[model samples]
Target: MTRHFSETEVVAILDDLNPARLRSFVAARVVTPLQTPQGQAFSEADLARLQLLCDLSEVYDLPDDALAMVMSLIDQLNTARGDMRALIQAVATEPDEVRGRIMTHVRSIRVTGRG
Candidate 1:
């Protein structure tokens, strides 16, 4: 089972995080936490994102809007990576000739800089 942390636990775990900052993050819709009967619940992924947010804020001193944009780009990149993984798996299931043809087309596209 995935471990979920309470708001308090999250604040405790992240050294630079405070209640006010966390509230701001939630308000900005940057780091979304699960709303449970007990209160807000954060997953491991949320924790990692929060850590990254903190690092970015400290390093770049970016505003909420800029941070959100950067996060959005990161999300898109991750989704594309996942899609590519699925595509690779699907292609791997094809017969040798099909795979060879696919590779040839891919190589030609790369070499000619065309789709």
Candidate 2:
């Protein structure tokens, strides 16, 4: 099981966000985590997401709404990737032309259904 981060650990991981950026992300509701009795609780995943937001801020000069849209698209892409990884692994285990044939058959099935 994944270990939950303590507040100190969370701060250590997230301290890369300078005070100004941290305020911006919090204001944008992009840095929210579960509040625990001791302190704020952030999943490790949030660290990665925050890093991506920081990168977007640096590279693209993304405003709040644009950053939100980019993050939303990132979520969509990540979901698609998870689905595709299993498919890709299955395809890799197949014989060389088998994958191609499967794609061909799928296309044919779709074409027939459309007709």
Candidate 3:
């Protein structure tokens, strides 16, 4: 079973995080937690994201909007990486000739800067 953290526990875990800021982050949709009968429950992923947000805010002094934009870009990049991994796995299952052809096409696109 996955361990879920309450808001109080999350605040205690992250040094730079406070109740007000956590609430603000949630309000901004930066760190979404699961709602349960007990109240908001944070996953490990949420904990890591909260840490990252604290770093971004403290180190870069980013406003909420800027943080949201940065987070969105990060999320998009992660999605693209997952998609690329899936494509690579699919290509790996192909015959050698097909794989070679695909690699050649990819190299040509890279060389021509067309992709």
Best by lDDT: 3
Against the true structure, candidate 2 reaches a TM-score of 0.64
Clashing residue pairs, candidate 3?
A: none
Worst 10 residues of 3 by lDDT: 106-115
lDDT of candidate 1 at residue 102, scale 0 to 100:
97
Better of 1 and 3 by TM-score: 3
- Identify the runs in model 3 with alpha carbons over 4 angstroms from their true place: none
Provide TM-scores for the models.
Answer: 0.96, 0.64, 0.97
TM match of model 3 to true structure: 0.97
**What is the C-alpha lDDT profile of model 3 across 1-115, one tens digit per residue?**
8899999999999999999999999999998999999999999999999999999999999999999999999999999999999999999999999999999999999999886
Residue 95 displacement in candidate 2 (angstroms): 12
Q: What lDDT would each prediction earn against the true structure?
A: 0.95, 0.77, 0.97
**Over 4 Å off, model 1:** none
lDDT of 2 by residue, 7-32 (tens): 56655676556656765776788768
Q: For each predicted model, how many residue pairs clash, with residues at least 3 apart or on different chains?
A: 0, 0, 0
* Model 1 TM-score (2 dp): 0.96
